[model samples]
Target: MKEILRSYKQTPASSIAARCIPITAKGVVRGRLRPITGDTLQNPAEIKLIAEWREASADWFTTRFPLSEAGTSRWLEQVWRADDRILFFVEDEECTPVGQVGILHYDPLKKQCEFDNLLRGRKGKFGNIMIYALITLGIWTIEELDVMEGFIRVVADNYRAIRMYESLGAEEIERTSLIRLEENGVTRWVPGQPGSSPPPERELATMRIKREVFLKLHQSNLPT
Candidate 1:
């Protein structure tokens, strides 16, 4: 899996292409998950949509900062160049871009990854879009990437997201204090740092899910 990811990172952005992951419900296709690549960023509308989604969902994340189109482009370009990261924009049955999901910190040896950037860019777009997108990514990790387990860290106060993960078979494995730090105008919550003290409200919940467990729970809904 690491070799595959390393190869992907080495590939030139212009040469990279999006992959289609079928999102199914009860053996029926509901939507699709498309990997974000340099080609995907070429479309102004698509890029703007992604930026907007990220900005709107900023509060739900551990990091919060002002977002700009250029900044978004730079951030995504870096992701495209990273060996251990991949993100996908979710689409509905109608093919409307609704949100994004990604996995990072991939450890090939342990076959483990951390779920990142799970957010619905558009409000009232698809009620269960995140769930479908998550399942799609999980399938890719287990079936395609050969990852055995996955983890996700969520802000302890973010109930909505926590509920969603729990519903999808994730279990809380640990709780870590978040040290809030502000540099320039951006504010972020880090697990810890030298000479840092965490506020009581700044807590993060780490959750884990096994590949076999996730697949077993959604096996019927998965496509053949």
Candidate 2:
């Protein structure tokens, strides 16, 4: 398992994007998860779609700023080359992207990783594509990457996301006050920084679930 993790970490982003991991539900392929590659940024339409989604879902994220296609292109370039992270696009069966998810903050020694950047851009014919996307990603981490646990941090007020995580067997494990940071006209909420005066009332909830627990809860919900 460690070797498998090492291999994935060493794989180039271009190759990763070409590899499609299917997201299935009820014995049907609902969507696919593919890593964002440099080629993805080359497509103007793709960049626009991602920027639009981020702008519309700004409030659901810690960082709130105006998103532009150029900015989105820069972010994609950075994330695709990251050593310990892979940002994925959730594409419907027809290969049209409907959302995005990511595996990041991996700790090989702990065999854990974080699920981040989960945002549903548009509804799919399956209706619950986002839920299946999350479940499928979780299963992949455990079965293929040997991740023992998966976790996510959500804005405390984001009740919809929290409920979805709970339904998939995650439980709130901790809460930390969020400190607002303003720089260059961009506002973001982050964990307390050193020398910070005081924590703000805004908070983020950390939710976690064991690999086996999550698998047991949803793996059987879909057919092999």
Candidate 3:
């Protein structure tokens, strides 16, 4: 098992240009997001354990595909070097990595990006970390990068995740239709609307938390 610690450092404002800003919420007790690096994948046991937790709880996540050790390592490298995205490992009070989260598939032209991967500890600590992270990121994007909006896509049935986002002021913009061709050559659409074939097991719901609302949430939560 991995040990948890709180020696991790906070992300600098300048560093957000190329790295994720590590942050700690009120009840986290300890831990914060850390920059993804080669060393992050050195411990395969911890990585695999987190992946299993995510897979077993697919309903709470958007993408169901699990990353292999190699895939995971490569992903860290891309996010670390990519200016369009930021990645971080959610570390515990003991410095042990629990789960991960990131902003990917960034489109600067649209001033919009997709947020995903808000995995928490096996015991479910740090569940609200993403809320703080998103709020901070949204403020940075708007004030620094001129981004107007941030978007997140969750599994339609992932009530927990949806509730979290809505609590932070995210609003559902549209329900997307995802078509998947099964092994039996059957096409499926999500939600399985009446008169329509049942969609794939995974359905996606897109939600947006505007820059203004995000800032409001951030300010409201700050110490008086």
Candidate 4:
């Protein structure tokens, strides 16, 4: 939209920033979050993920995500300046790092944004669950911070993530098949192609959730 806070910028005096960013930096609380930026990308903590984590978390992110290495940095910078996007490292009770989660492209006017760059490097029993839990917190945090509605587009083939999102109260809205298209130096995943004999049946699952649903779920799970 070439619009408001296009890069996740933070107000120096923001109470939310003070309350959230420090804990995020401290890396103790689960789902602790901070805005991502190129400047912070090479922080010692992130460097550890690359030097320690088996997949070399840095490589995995660049390989799996749509952006190039530089592009990813730019994306982070943009997201940081916008201040709506959240980039987080999931932590366990003892402050062990588990994974990374993010929510970006938020539009306060429409009160929505897509979830992306959700990756988990931790292994074992709670490893997988930690990422999903972080995602849950990320979604709710976004809802409380800016958006009232949130949506995600999941590839039909990604059964695990789809199931997890459903577990988080997301309702599927569409299952239209899509095709991969490369035009004018840009690539897109879209439904069907004109005069292209109907693309393959593979598609994306559109899912949605509301603030109320997440809030009720969160409150219901909290101790009395």
lDDT for 141 in candidate 3 is: 52
lDDT against the true structure, each candidate:
0.80, 0.82, 0.59, 0.55
TM-score for all models, in order of appearance: 0.88, 0.87, 0.68, 0.65
What tens digits encode model 4's per-residue C-alpha lDDT throughout 109-184? 7877777666666752443445445444544455355667778777778788788878777889887666666566
Kindly list the per-residue Cα lDDT of model 3 for residues 169-189, writing each as its tens digit: 889988765544444533334
lDDT of 1: 0.80
Task: Quote the lDDT for 199 in model 3.
Answer: 41
**How badly does each model clash, as a count of residue pairs?**
0, 0, 7, 12
Q: In candidate 3, how many Å is residue 209 off?
A: 0.9
Any idea how many clashes model 4 has? 12
TM-score of 2: 0.87
Say which prediction, candidate 1 or candidate 3, comes out ahead on TM-score: 1
Model 2, C-alpha of 57: deviation from truth (Å): 0.8
Off by over 4 Å in 3: 1-30, 41-43, 60-67, 74-83, 124-130, 137-144, 183-202, 221-224
